[model samples]
Target: MNESYKIISSSILYWFSQKKWFVYSILIALFLLSLSTPVGLTLPAYHSLIILVLVFILVTFEPIPFPAIALLTLVLQVVLGVAPPNEVASSFMNDAVLFVMGSLMFAIAIVHQGLDIRLARMIIYFFGKSKRLFLMGLMTISAILSSFLGEHTVIAIMLPIGLSVIKNIDTQKTDGKNAVLLTLFSVAYGTIIGSIGTPSGGARNVIMINYLQEFSNVNIDYWKWMKHAYPILIIQLLVAYFVLQFTFPSSLKNIQIKGFKKKVQASDTKKNINHLFSCLIIVFIIFSWFTFNDKYGLGIIALAGALSFMIFGMISWEEINKNTNWGVILLFAATISLGFQINETGASSWLVLKFNDLLEALPSNSFNISWSIMAIISGLTANFFTSSATVSLIGPMAIELQPTDITFALSSAIASGFSFLTVISSPTAMILYSTGLVSTKLFFRVGILMFSISIIILYLMSQFYWINI
Candidate 1:
């Protein structure tokens, strides 16, 4: 009896230790629920806010698997009477979720084709001898590819090339080490900056677009999105080149391009005919996104592109299944559902009202002030959590803040791409960190400057260029 009692106690302690954040979140939820609903908010809205707080904690700490947290998010809505089962079901799946799924699958298909080698060859041929020119060339290519292919995919492709160049450098010296870090940061920053360029660049963009359409009845197609964002992307790229150079000044003026070329030549550099077909399919999908996105929606078109790859036998379902992050897809859907409930229950409006009250002492509650606040909050939130999840929660609040103006939603979305401050903020950053060369301290140091510059640039664009567009 004593031994059995000890074993039971030990098992309970183990579970508690492993799932401490889960316990803390539940306890916090209970504490919040014990309080009476605020005067201006309905009971349902208050409860939804509690759930939001619970979810924020869970997502940030990740005490549970994402799929489980997703399930909890859906279950809490129904249990708390925030929404009915049917409403929850409907909100759980939407174009934004579909777009995320399709894009992940499509990215997997594209990455499986081993195009990074070819991309490396192009970079070498164009800007290989001069270090500064090579850095700019690499950053430009990474940004452009990430603008369409998504930053995570672009990082997976570009990191290897960056490392290849770095491996040839003399890392034992401070100059060589700085060069290595600079190359890696170029890839990472480029991918991050370009993620705001179009809807396809990141799930956050698509989520924000969905919010704009659902809340404000405003539709921004791929072309319009690029028109608003690509200029910012271009400007950020130029600024980032200077920032990275200033942060990591290396004495290495030139690199041995011949060595990299020989390495590429030794590899199986033969082009596959199927690659052309894959490229055509991708181009067709992009063209369709630019032309017919309004007709079919971005999610449907992205899925169609993934299907084309499967239909042509260019990528197998098994490969995609193995690679795609279904948990994240489900989480996106769940958080999106939670976002809908927050808006429907009027929690977002209440929060916005409070948000305004806090800002009421200002000279004027103008759109510019609101835009800057929203951008800074979204940008900072994204640095701590995943950008898509950040948008899933914050996008609704942004739309509620300015339902009539699309800039609020757009600024929130674009600013969320400033995931430069932390190693775990975005997958691109994580991948770069995984190379084990760049330190977290270095990341934070460089990120502070870039993050500030990005916010300033975004504000200027919104104030100047975006207004014209």
Candidate 2:
């Protein structure tokens, strides 16, 4: 009996050691739950805030799987009386969630068709003259494609092209390694910067749009979104090019290629009529997004595109199921639901009041200064958390910051796309890191510079450019 008790105790201790983050989150939640509600906030609102804290801890550490975290969010909402079961159910699934699901599926379809190979050929055709031009072209093309598609989709497609280029080089030398790192970083950061250019560019953009319409009644369409965000995208791309060049200098001036062109051409010949059909389908989807997104939400249009790909036999359902990350979709849905509850329970308004109180303490908390502060917070938060999750949580407070001015909301949404600070901040960064060429130390070093410049560019655009548009 003594030996059995010791074994049981050891097992329990081992389990606790493995799951300390989870235990810490629960204890924090309980401690907060035991406190009296804040003077101005309702019980439900206060409980929602506690859930928010719990979620931040869980997501930051990821003590459990993402789908489990998503399910816990829904369960906590009902259990804590933040909302009724029916309301929770309604909020769990929405157009934003659908868009995320469809976009992931869409990326699989595009890559499955092997269009990325053809895209690589075009990049080499246009900018194969000089090493600097090739790097610039990669960044420019990635930014352009990602503005319409998405960072995940563009990076998935562009990574292979960059790798193909790097494969032809000698990585044992310092210049060759720098060239490789520069190419990969260009693809990653360009895709990230361009993801803010349109409503369809990233799921976080769609989430912000949904929140804007649902909470603030501000109806911004695809073109309007592009008008506000595209200039900043262009500016960031240019700045990133120089920053990347400075960080990873390569003195080898000429493109040294023997048979890559011939190899790409040989693969191009294998493309049949199905590839043409795929191109047509993508063009139609982009047209629909630009022309009819106001009539049909971006989610429905994205779903329609995915369905088209399946109907035409361009991609199989199994392919999508195998490639898509469903946990992210569910987590986006859950966090979005929490965001809605935060607003409905008046928690966001209370937060805005408290924030305003803090802002007032500063000597020069002008409108521009306030906007910059919120954008900086959103960008910083996005660096630690997924951009979609950051928006799902921080977006409501932004809308509440200035109920009358939409600039505050737009800045927050756009700034959240600046996720260049960490490897896990965006999928593009993760994909780049997976190549094993870019070290974590080097990634963070360049990211600090890119993130800082991007924030400054965003501030300038908001002050000078967005107002005119």
Candidate 3:
């Protein structure tokens, strides 16, 4: 009897220890819900506010898998009467969610075809002469590809190239280590900066575009979005390169890439044909997005691209199903639904009003102050939560602040993509962190500098450039 009792006790303790944060989060959410509603607040809005707070805490700490958090949010919306079952269900699926799903599948298909080998050879052939030139070429290639192919996809393709180069280095000295770190970060930061350049680059951009259209009736097409954001992307790329050079100054003057030509020669005819076909499919999808996105929508075009790969036998369904991260897609869908609930229940508008009251006491009357505050908040939040979630939470509030100020709304969303302080800040950062060459401490150290520079650049752009454009 005593043995059984001890076993049960141990099991209970272990479960509690494993889920302590989850329990704590639930308690805090319940405690907040128990409070009396503020003046002029409806019960539904109050309940949604409580759920939103819970989501932020749970998502930040991640006491459970992100998909579970998303499921919890969906259940609570109905269980707590924040929204009807039908309404909550409707929010679970949308164009943004579809786009995320389709994009992930397409990315997996493209990566499965093994085109990275050809890409690496091309990179080395072009930039193999010197260390500095190679770094520049890597960053430029990463940025240009990511601006259209998506940050996660580009990183998946480029990360191995960086790692391969590092592996080929002949020395185990500190200088060699610095060279490896700089090369990896060049690809990582390039992918990150370029993700803001186009709507197709990241899901946050699509979420923000959806929010703008739904809330303000403002439609920013693919071309317009690129035109507005590409300048910032270009400037950030330059800043990132210089900052990396300063931070991890290379000791080597020149380095030669060995056996690159032999590898290029070894590529067989079938692989080359497959790669060329994949390239054509990618080009077609990008062209369609730029030209026909308004009619067929970006999500549908992405899905069609994935279908094209399958139709042409470029990739198998088993590969895509095995490799794709569907949980992320579901999480995005739930957060978007939660954002809709926040807006529908007046929670976002209430928060905006509170923010305005807080800002009214500031001595500066300049609109730049407001824009900077919003950008800072969005950027900081993005460093912790994913950028898509940041946009979902803050996009509505920015629109509520001034629907007419398209610049302010779009800037707030785009600037949130400048998540540089943590590996969890963006998928590109997380992928680079997986390389095991980058320590978390080093990441934060370099990331903080880049974060500061990006914020200042974004603020200045909002003040002068974005305002004019």
Candidate 4:
């Protein structure tokens, strides 16, 4: 009994030590809430503003897990009477949340089938001899696959391929580190750029779609979304390839990826069948998303793919339950709820009103200035916060600012996916960083360059292509 008491005490102490910053953050938020009241804002709007600030700080510093921040957001909303309990609860289970959950499950099933090995073999078979060609192939594959399979899924599938090649390189050589960094960045930046290509590519895209539909009654279907964003994705993929190649030039003329094809061929017949079936299911899902998304949303179609995997016994629920990052799903749901409350309570409009003077100062000739400003704000904010959170905060404001110009508003949201500044900027970057081959400093160093290029590309697209579209 005495030993149990000591163990419990020690556990409590350790938890507090780990979470002290979070505790301080909560206290600071409450203090700020108590003292804050801008004139002409409703009580709920004021409270929402305080909560948004708290969330921004907590998410940026990340003293706790994202899900914890999300739970805190929901709890505070009810406890502070900023929103009704039922409304908050209802907001947490939207179609966007369901889509995230379903897509993650589908991703797990696809990864479980071990098809990426074949994919790696194919990539090497075509581009094994030339350093630049290999890098371009890897990036192109990552971009195209990510546009359909989502960035998290594509990165998870591709990271091991890049890591294996890096591991094969002679680390004693002076150019080894450069080769590894370039390869990893090819995968990382490719996935990041492709995330803006389609609604299923990332959660932020879906969230923006939901917001546009809900707030403006403007429905952007899958093909329409692709048309608007795919050109940017293609150009960015090439730009990332050139930027990575220029920044970290590989000295090796050729790389031999041995045994990948043999390993793929060694898989048994049953495994091959499973792989083929999984690919077909994924393709079918994408096709359906393109053809029938108006009838059945992307979330339901993704869940159907997951279900197909289960019915065919290609993947088990036990495996998915263990592998899935439920915290991310929960975080997305809570953030969506918070965004809804921001809009519902007039907090977003109030915030926009604060910026109205500056917006009015711009020349009245064209909306190019406003579009650039919105894109810059969204892109920069995404570097610190999750892309979904950035959209959740900014989407409502964009809609409030220009209810009729949804094309510009969505362009801003799409550009925010250019999360090229930090490890925490996007999940793809975090996954790549986890490989230990890429350093945080290197990520930022390369990211800032890519971020600048992305802004230029997006600005040009906004002015020329998007306007005509």
Assess each prediction's global lDDT (C-alpha) against the native: 0.89, 0.87, 0.85, 0.83
The deviation in Å at residue 147 for candidate 3 is 1.0
- Tens-digit per-residue lDDT, 225-307, candidate 3: 99888998999999999999888877743243454445555778898899999999999999999999898888889898899
Candidate 1 lDDT score at position 238: 95
Candidate topping lDDT: 1
Clashing residue pairs for model 4? none
Candidate 2 on 1-469: residue-level lDDT in tens? 6999999999999988878899999999999999999999999999999999999988888888999999999999999999999999999999999999988888788888888767877888898776678778889999988988899889988888777767867878888778878888888888998899999899999999999999989999999999999998988998898888888788753235334567677654337576788788889999999998988888888888889999987778988998899989999999999999999999999998998898899997778777888999999898888788999999999999887677888888898899888887889988888888887788889888888888888888878887787
What TM-score should be assigned to candidate 1?
Answer: 0.96
- Using lDDT as the measure, name the better of candidate 1 and candidate 3: 1
Per-residue lDDT value at 292 in model 3 = 96
Per-model TM values vs. the true structure: 0.96, 0.96, 0.96, 0.93
**Candidate 1 stretches greater than 4 Å from native:** 1-7, 253-255, 266-271
lDDT by residue for model 1 (129-228), tens: 6877887889999999899979877988888888877677777888888888888889899999989999999999999999889988998889899999
Candidate 3: which stretches are off by over 4 Å?
A: 170-172, 253-256
Q: After aligning candidate 4 to the native by TM-score, how far in Å is the CA of 259 from where it should be?
A: 4.6
- TM-score of candidate 3 versus the correct structure, residues matched by position: 0.96
